[model samples]
Target chain A: MRVSKFDRPYESGRPERHQLRVENISLSFGGVRALTDVSLTCEPGEILAIIGPNGAGKTSMLNCICGLYHPQKGRIMYGNHNLARTSSHHLPKMGIARTFQNIELFRHMTVLNNLMLGRHVHMKKNILTALLYWGWAEREEIENRRFVEHVIDLLEIQHIRKQMVGSLAYGLQKRVELGRALAMNPGLILLDEPMAGMNVEEKEDMARFILDINEEWGITTILIEHDMGVVMDISDRVAVLEFGRLIGIGTPDEVRENPDVIRAYLGQDHGGRS
Target chain B: MMATTQCGVFHESYRSDMQLRPTTWQRLRVVVVFAFIIILPFVASAQNLRIANTVVIAAIGAIGLNILVGYTGQISLGQGAFLAVGAYSTGLLMHYYELPWPIALVLGALITAMFGAVFGIPSLRLKGLYLAVATLAAQQIVGWFVRNWDPIDGTKADGAARELSMPRALFFGDKLNDSEFAFYVVGMIALVIVAVVATNLFRTHIGRAFVAIRDQDIAAEVMGVNVFQYKLVAFATSSFFVGLAGGLTAVHSTNISFERFTIDVSIEYLAMIIIGGLGSISGSIYGAAFVKLLPEILRDVGLWIADQGWLASGQLDQYLPFAEDAAFGLAIILTLIFEPEGIVKLWSDLKAYFRLWPFSY
Candidate 1:
């Protein structure tokens, strides 16, 4: 099989020329290989979706990219920096932000406060200044609040900004989680199932928001989602994973026509490519 | 134009636009409390004032424990250890070295904060039951070491043991033998600590991170909070205050012993936080006062009952034996069962009901 023309241009930017590069990564937990030789490339201003079945290490791959779990083998390169050696706390400042599979919003904090936490890395004022809330600290606080208000407006969650996150509806809570990640204003945003348990209309809305975030903000997005239709619609390129290995990587149409991807999804031989 | 601007200004001054504090009722309450504290020594008996001083000292300890256990959700049974460190540090400095009172107090807090950080390192790595055991072990080890150390007891004989002694006072080159003066000092320190704690908490990122880690550690980590660093900071801050309270306690009393800073004292502080309400500044003070004064009240009742002619004094000793301990245990169990949120919740609800009396649904 030959690489398609549309896929070739995307491949030129592979691993080396991109903002985040995951090369031949493998991770094992207690004798169980969670990820094996999974390689993916994410560039600036692109939506790269990773589609696979459950336990295919989609989230584990994201964890490795964000420096949560150091892969047993392989390297993660982020803009001339080796992610393997970088601390987890430094990842956010390095322009990498991620959300969880289960919504991990700070339930007790107000929606505004939760978003404010995302800006913790950027807030420069120290403890003494913050205690006084005068001089540079007050200015910093106002600037951060203005940025957070912009995020709240962009997500259309202004009405519930003061309300506790735990009291919001599930769909609204998911939106607030995205707002929190957006507050970081990262170069690459990792979304772990952004529209997991939503209705069709909600999924469509989230897909539009994801596309808007990529096109308008020029932020690269690496999304792990199971809904192929939503992934196919929003993603410029998609990677298919089966048993922690990359089975297909191409444009949506080429991946749709791949024989291995078809087998991985349908669990049987399909005459799409062969 | 003037009329329109006046109307806009009037609208801006609506009831909902009012500030959070210094309400009419709150102002009156503050005035009353200040007056009560000022006049209390004159009206209350000396024994009663002594008990009040104990409550104030316990309040200081409870506030410190609240920072560790209430806001940060770290299980710490070594608060009593920090207290002992502070008391002994102050005692040694004032008695042996003849340091000034203010300098001794500062040194006591600093030494305790350093010790707290050492214990906090393991606490950051281990949590829940393991953390509890670690702090409990600290309490035991520190208590035993201080009790057995010959220099601390000021005994010249190699094996002789005695209770440690604290200097009466550090100011004016004179001792503070009066109970009233001790009461005033403890009360002033307690008031200042509560104010500072109330102001600093929730104002800085450290405070918010402590609360965030308490609610969800994983989420806090994902949000770029250094959980280990914040946990250690919580321990250091909490223990420093505990040490300050210990120093005040040593000054408040004539003598100190290992028994005063035992695991039981730690449990008593825990009970104060639990019965007062977790995560509330006012709750710590309330719990401390209730736990400290309840026994004395019960003892008075027991004495009155013994004199009621229904029971002879000799028989009363047998029947109502250990009345103080029994009351403390009963109060803890009853508070847990009926008002798990603690006395703070009850106070809040009462105030809320009054505020929204006619409109409450």
Candidate 2:
């Protein structure tokens, strides 16, 4: 809420972090319901995982919270603001950032540029200064780039920092996407299936990165992952959805023992993917 | 802190690491090219200077157009129309209002920026070919207004294009009387400023927002890039350059006419960016040079053929214009068919191939 200087450490660095509260939000496309009366609170600075089968409206739920999809029914609140009224473009300015289900990086740009782009909301705008690359623009650029370097370091993407995002491997692209979201320095991060296509080693790396993001920066993470093993390993809490409804929401062990969650998700597939 | 560089080179600070031209070799190349540019006027004839001015002006305009269609992925068929706005605005300001040429030129460009933003409004709802068609409306409307409005030297007949002249620019009370050479230097300066500004823009977050929107709009929006705002900014920025080009055309040619900037000119601008390279800044200049030079080269070749007795002079004259037009069409087709990425990519590939000479395949 304090909007003065652009060069604050990160949104997560701010002391007054607020939790995301989604209240009875219902979303549907024609007759097919994407999310039906789904309501859950994302606690500040915790890695919360939402796991379900395909078309279970996990991304839709994220989208509604992201302002990409406005729920037809109830209010989704991020701190003091009602997200229904907040435009999607202003989400990052409000300290909210999300990565996509598929890698949605600026393909032609190098990894550095993509990460710097995540700093878009924070960058001061002065065309004359930017064009001349002097004073405010030059000083601002080096400062933000210093932050992006930290992200590249955190994600261990030092080697591919200058490589074009398109030329990078799928796992690397996903990590870069996460790096981009991290570059925003958001208090809350929505990651849609960050480990969908990764191999086991890649998955483990992504899991560690996700945990580091949550623990070190205290970035509240709402991760949608299908790999239950990875999900249970990293998530502080688990929310299970089936056919557009939340079957259960609790700690990983509590969700694993829930009767409905067992029948719907864990029973069909033991510790691996269903 | 230590930083990585080409084996021997090292960057010890962020400012050093983030330099536009970090290496000695790169700095030397820039200085050498600038030195050559400074000496060019002394050696080149007036005719060559005139032609080079045209190419430089085209490059400026192409850079603008490329920012919209090529970099930002917003197709505009109103480039020529925007050019007319610049030309006529500068022409009217200099002639009737008697404003200083520099002030008039800047005002003219700014005026065209407003016009571009007005036309770009529809882009929020339209895209691709649909957007192209929408922009074409600007070409028609501007063309119609110039042909009908009396202040702009309107003519009753359809093909009768009236010329509106602009006064010569006075620099420190000097008339800039070196003529073609003066215009060439001015054109080169403008080209350098525009190119450098664009290059600087792409390195920052503003430029990243434009590319992000182009690559993926939804992601850009969610990532906090105001998509519609940036699209309008692209339109206005591109028009500022294009309008500057048009204003220069008025001052350089000393005459502005509707006939000179028709839809054909708009298409030519599009071809320049397309043949140069999409989403590449330097590609705009390359494309502009190729397109503007194609006709001149064709004419010279045609004249040579006639002089060599391969074709009669009278017969060559009859088909020369047709040949030039056909060559333009053919060049675009050939470029698209072979190197769809355009001349920029082709030039880069050639450099890469030759980097490891003789022994390499």
Candidate 3:
């Protein structure tokens, strides 16, 4: 459902979104190579899922794109800005948003506050105005609150909007995490394990929300998720990782049949190599 | 999921939901509180009014401490030093420059904020106990400067005197001299302005940013909060309120001394916020009053015990003075033991209990 609000002031005259491009990035800590010359490109509005076995550097690759990790080599570009060089703090303003593998919510605050914080980059603030809470701050807050409410509606979290996020159930927390990333109104979203440790039903719910967020907002999604069935069903393109190396990068069907992907990652259920 | 803050009450709009006080009971409570404050001077004695003024002034400082320590999750031990900076700046502006007290207070708060921001520099690189120690240096350094600096030693030329005194301020046209009732207007105004400003601050993005920085700095940073800048802003905002308290204190007594704003004084303000509630604005007021009043009440209790022949009168006199210090220690211990989240949790629990009052469900 389209959000009914027409007075989204900042949504007007928006610049065209830039495609995310990662060119041969490598990352290491001390002596351990977390990612080795990993390179991939995400078009402006496609969901690219990175599938890998445990310890296959999926999170690390997502981290590099979000500026949480600076690559030792290769250029990570989103639009014109180099993700490797730009401060992680600046990424949100540039319309880059992400959720964590382990939820990093402001635990003390309510769900409403957490979601409002997601709009921090877009909210205009002047300390004097904020001190009085009179004009610009109030206007920005109401406008943003209206926008965030639509996200709440989208995620079906209207019931728990006032609940403290820290006290919520795990599946609920994951949904709230996604809602927070969506609250950024980002052009590009990198979800690091958006659905992990959930019942099949909750997984389906999260998957549907992912699809909705991408299709409704036209947000370019770079998702790192396990659960191959869900990933293959939802993603437009799939990249396979093994031992810090990209073995295959193509459509879900293309990667499914690739001999290296099956042998390295997809062959876990079978006793023999593909 | 269908529950409401009040069983029958529900918000119809986001604007109503965003309100600081949305309920009829809360609005009435505010009006009742203002009425009580308005009637207080008439019923209270001059000495009682003086203490009330002191309590409110302490409330201002405690609120300041809460902003940094509780809300922002930035620990501060320099509360006393920041207060001294404020007190001294207010005193200096009044004595040397002949500025009016209100202007002096405003300027003093600004000056104190600068000091707060500068001392808060180490916080960007350090936190917790390390930040506490770094801020402790502010208390020491400012104390030393007050004692040693010839110029800061009030209006005395002998250089032996450490206390500074200022003439009484004229409020609107009348002199606020000698009467606690008159001086109370200044304290009340400062408290109201501060409490409102502080409460308003948290409802907006700036206040939320402080909380975000405190709760999850990395997430906040990635989510586009300038963590370093917000941290400094927290320091400055907290110090500004502390300074206002100091300025009020200056106006209340029309004098200042190093002993008055000592390390113990700093610890007392810290104790106020801790005992009141970290990050709770009202808890600051409650804490300041609790910290200030409990000791005096204990002293009275000590005297009453002596009067009632429960203890030897002369024998108790020697230790009667220690009752205040003893009360401080006891209050902290009891608060930690009974309500670790401080009085704020107790208040919330009380509200929750009443929310389902018909049964203990």
The C-alpha TM-scores of every prediction are 0.88, 0.93, 0.94
Q: What is the DockQ of each candidate?
A: 0.19, 0.47, 0.57
Supply the TM-score for candidate 3. 0.94
lDDT of 1 by residue, B150-229 (tens): 66875435444446777777445445435565556546655665545544555445666777788778767766788888
Question: What 10-residue stretch in candidate 1 chain B is worst by lDDT?
Answer: B1-10
Scored by lDDT, model 1 comes in at 0.77
lDDT of each: 0.77, 0.85, 0.86
Candidate 1 chain A TM is 0.90
- The candidate, 2 or 3, that scores higher on lDDT is 3
Q: Give the per-residue lDDT of model 2 (tens digit) for A119-235.
A: 888897766677777667878988788888888878889888878889888999999999999898888899999998889999989988888778777789999998889889889
Order the numbered candidates by TM-score, best leading.
3, 2, 1
Q: Give the winner by lDDT.
A: 3
Candidate closer to the true structure by lDDT (higher is better), 1 or 3: 3
CAPRI rating of model 1: incorrect
| C-alpha lDDT (0 to 100) for residue A162 of candidate 2 | 77
**Residue pairs in candidate 3 whose N, alpha carbon or C atoms collide under 3 angstroms:** B70-B279
Give the poorly placed runs of model 1, Cα more than 4 Å off: A1-18, A124-140, A270-274, B1-35, B155-161, B170-177, B314-321, B359-361
